[model samples]
Target chain A: MGLLKKRKREGGEIPTASMADIAFLLLIFFLVTTTIDVDTGIGMVLPPKLEDDVEPPPIKERNVLKILVNETGQVLVEDQPSAIRLIRDEVKKHVLNEGVDPRYSEAPGKALVSIKTARQTPYDAYVGVLDEVWMAYFDMWDSEARRLGFPDYATYSAAVAEQGAENQIRDKIKAAISIAEPDKQ
Target chain B: MASSHFKKKTSVKQEIPTASLPDIIFMLLIFFMVTTVLRETTVQVRTTLPQAEALTKIDQKRLVSYIYIGPKKLDGNRLGETGVQIDDALVEDMGSVRTIMYRKLIEQPKLIVSLKVDQTSEMGIVLDVQQELREAGALRINYSSKREIPS
Candidate 1:
């Protein structure tokens, strides 16, 4: 009877002392191997393919801020040789001109920043110029947001998103950037 | 008297209650298991992305498709001519990109093409690829770049 009782007690419980160790081992393996880096980048929308016979809309020369990047990574703004660093300020001034400067745009809505690159232009150089243009617009939006009693544009945009409202700032001061095709190689 | 008191204290049965330890570990293990992505595509080219300030995070990974453009990685640390890779294969003919991307767009109409171009590549190939994308009607593209650290 005593032997039978010992067998019953032994079979009643399985050893769980090492379960924590086993779990910790698997957890450590996964923890060390897991990668959760988020992908980030500059987003853009390309123009749709145009029909051959269709005529493209024409914009006045004065309203366009033409930026050109050549094979050697040199930059030109409005037909003037310029550095990449100055492109941001030029973009801002052109966009916020309000018709005060005849050389710039007639109005914020009419302002179009056109980027043209050579076929041999380095990818990084193009990205650099594009980055500057985007930064200029971002700065403009920030000031606009501040004027409207918000901390910054991001917060204001977030609030607008929450209420499912249109982004007035973006609509008012649109980022009318155009990426012109490179000359045929 | 002090030695006897120390001996009596040491003789008392003392054990840490570890019943919940396994449960805690299992919870953590499950979390890691769920969040881990086991299968990732092996990249063929050496695409060191450019750095920029104005960056937007792509929240949904499902809506994005990657296109890598860089110098082809040859055997023994040698790099060949610039090549464009979509999925696993290097696109031999530039015209075929339109068909491949069009098929992808059919599958996911909201497809966002993430262009992971190497910093050293020229604009010629990039434009060619972009034209093909335009033909495919996949106009939404993202230039995959790292955030520039402010000086």
Candidate 2:
């Protein structure tokens, strides 16, 4: 009977006086140490590395849209000195070549927009050339999307918002821009 | 009309309980501590990545290996000298990139080598780095640049 009888418990609570202080300390620590960096870039998938150079089958010259950026930052579209701003329109026209010029690409699929930059070319110049090429593809996609009834087809966010024919539009607009190995001057 | 309520009022002083405040705060603190990931490496050399209108974000940070190309921070000795930084270390010869990155490729097979190059730097250095990277078989590359919001 005595063993079965338990002592009376005392009312006690956890010491939370310092809880807010501790929380504030931690919040401050994180606030001070946090680095919310927004990182986004141009993604490129490079072909596998080769041990030795190999010869390839010959292809017709009509499909090639050769763009050359020399060491002195001279950008030439099909061996002609082209202004930076001209690259987008020139690339677009060449890619969708309506047979305007005999040297431009015949079709988008057969068209190869090859970018070759010299060793001494400035990074800005090189990226500028690549950006213009990318812009050409983006513009083509935009115009095509606009034709499909999406009037505001400027950025990817605009396309993602629309409900109909997403995959169809995306597949048709996806253009492959091949970057050749850099030529050492 | 409120006489009964007034009559029932106690003389004991009432105090707000704050003992549980720390626990709530601690829980929040722990949540933050667990979720926070320190990814940005302490950059040694000065780098100014070029801006581009089109960009894509790499969701997974683990798959990326940064190759920083820029002039070393001006400290009198290294003024006007452009150097290559792989990860966090400053590498000297361009030839070493292949070997260095090759080991990284072995560790992470699908490594995305992001080139965070300065706009003013010569393309020669970048090309050399790319040549080495190709030889190293670290193919999946990303050109790291800030978003160029039109003026």
- Highest TM-score against the true fold, candidate: 1
Candidate 2, A97-156: lDDT as tens digits: 756678887667666677888766788888888888888887887787677676645544
Clashing pairs in 2: A16-B19, A19-B22, A119-B124
Chain B TM-score, one value per candidate, order as shown: 0.82, 0.78
Q: Supply candidate 1's per-residue lDDT for A20.
A: 92
TM-score of each: 0.88, 0.79
Candidate 1 chain A lowest-lDDT run of ten: A7-16
For model 2, residues B3-41, the per-residue Cα lDDT tens digits are 867766755667888767777777877776765666657
Sort candidate 2 into its docking category.
Answer: medium
Candidate-wise lDDT, in order: 0.94, 0.77
Candidate 1 has a DockQ of 0.70
Quick one: RMSD of model 1? 3.3
For lDDT, the strongest prediction is: 1
lDDT value, residue B62 of candidate 1? 75
Error of 1 at A42 (Å): 1.2
Which stretches in model 2 have alpha-carbon errors above 4 Å?
A1-13, A51-53, A98-101, A148-174, A182-185, B1-35
